[model samples]
Target: MKIGKSKNLRVGEWVVAIGSPFQLRFSVTSGIVSAKGRSIPNGSDSTYVPFIQTDVAINPGNSGGPLFNLEGEVIGINSQIYTRSGGYMGVSFAIPIDYAMDVADQLKENGYVARGWLGVSIQEVTSELAEALGMEVPKGALISQIIADSPAENSGLKEEDVILFFDGEEIFYSADLPLTVGAIRPDSKVNAMVLRDGLKKTITVTVGELPKDPALAFNETQQNFLGLVVEDQINDGRRLYIEGVMVTSIDPEGLAYESGIRRGDIVYSLGRAKISNVNEFKEILSSLDQEKSTTIGISRNGNKRILSLNLSK
Candidate 1:
């Protein structure tokens, strides 16, 4: 069967789905492209896939079937449907063939799919945020936080910067930026135009291959002799966007925990020196005066405090 790209598909265009649902063999249904680039939380374990939404009758066995255009060329694969009674409710979704093909190509070549990744957390720019940032329009993605040691942190991207364009493509939405970046091959360098303090500037970032393990993607972590395993991430069981070295684990009888540091505590600074990323934090910690009392700043549950610890020489 011939295959076509879904990017050329338009909303309200006539489309067809061929599948077998509920023991019905070779069932066919028709629908229009209700929307594009829809994000839905599902069991697919895919957070970056922008599904093509439709009203086609997709259910049960229909999942792996083809969604074709009028020319009988497959544009997508029927994936899921929105329903309350465990039945079709007119809203269905499909994985865009173009994206599927890209993954397919990778799987065929490397036996594993590797997406382009930029280690940063982003949120959509709103009107109030735009006004606060002195932006003329509430478009583009606002960098909320950057992961330490990742491409974003190594590059010039900073917290609170508004990314307007990436690699010549305008980022109309935060979600758009992910899809745009994911489409690029890993290790590729791209120019990102950003607005910082009401000024526009371009930053070059080398895209990285998306890691299968979140721990690895973080580019953060080190097992220290202090009986503490630290990372460049902090999670309060809700979200991880803060900038600081974090204690992933620690020995209960270790000097760090005994010094009042706990797992999940964000190490903000040491010896009055502000910590930037994991590497710098490790460097500072290594060079600390042994057995001498040094002040360390930590934040837990939005509360900041200073603790004194002394390492034996």
Candidate 2:
């Protein structure tokens, strides 16, 4: 897969899709570059996977296929299709080769993607809400919730703060925050310009790793970290009754990566919690505030291991 430069995406230019559509191997579809930097939903998290919207007939088995330019250079990867009857609805989406390649590289290397942490929950601004807040409408993400102990919280970013610029990049919407933040290196300090109470202010923030589990009990809303979910697994007789918090997934660029924990890793204890499942471990983590760190003991692939993580407050 070729990683195209972000600047190379030309509008109205010819592009091709290479994939196995309808479970057919080696299928190729042709179309033009529809748009870039488009936003799509990813459950609770908003996916900034810029849609290479095309008229191509992308179907099943077409995933991972390349969308090539007229020059045969891969511009995007055919990924998903919007359909009501489980068929292409003429609005097929391809992951921009650049973005797809980036994600693939991160996933392959680190087990998950790493994003910058701004520590704020944002929503699209509305005229009524803007009027209520006494601001302009239809622009920028509204500060709906701010995570405590986050860079924004430490830097004085308050609720209703409208982020206008991150570093030097313009933040036209909330989705831009994750993209901008994710691009920053961990522990590096960056400036964020926000609109608060009609007054513009800049705050410096130290970037942190995106967490592997958003539902992690360490904090109610802290997901900017290395992704690795593990629990204690109890073994029984021939059935080998499995009970314990077992690692389901490990994100790339996380501390767990350095620790060599992979999928199916079973965690037994975190400082004597004796975790047997996700909920059991979650119960222990629930008591931990932002200032606490948890030392973990895990069993992976039948081997025992120990790791420590200072939970980000």
The alpha-carbon root-mean-square deviation between model 1 and the true structure, to one decimal in Å, is 11.2
Over 1-313, each residue of candidate 1 has an lDDT whose tens digit, in order, gives: 9999888899999999998898798999999999887755331235467789999889898998999999989999999887767899899999999989988999999998888888876766766678899987788988877877888888779998999999887887765776677777798999999999899999998998777864454332234656565555523256654568766545555677678887667888988888856778888988898868888898875678899888772
- State each model's C-alpha RMSD to the native: 11.2, 13.0
Candidate 2 wrong stretches, greater than 4 Å: 7-13, 23-26, 42-50, 104-112, 132-134, 167-170, 179-185, 188-191, 216-313
Q: Per-residue lDDT of 1-313 in model 2, one digit per residue for the tens? A: 5456644777778777877766778876777767655554322233435576777888878876777777667777677776657687777777666665666777888797776666665655555556776675545666767777876687777887888887776776555666567656557788878778787888887777666664432242223354554323322223533346655334544665555555555667766667765567767766655466667676644557788766662
TM-scores of all candidate predictions against the true structure: 0.64, 0.58
Q: What is the lDDT of candidate 2?
A: 0.63
Q: Rate the local accuracy (lDDT) of all candidates.
A: 0.79, 0.63
Q: What's the distance in Å from true for residue 187, model 2? A: 3.7
- Candidate 1 colliding pairs: 291-311
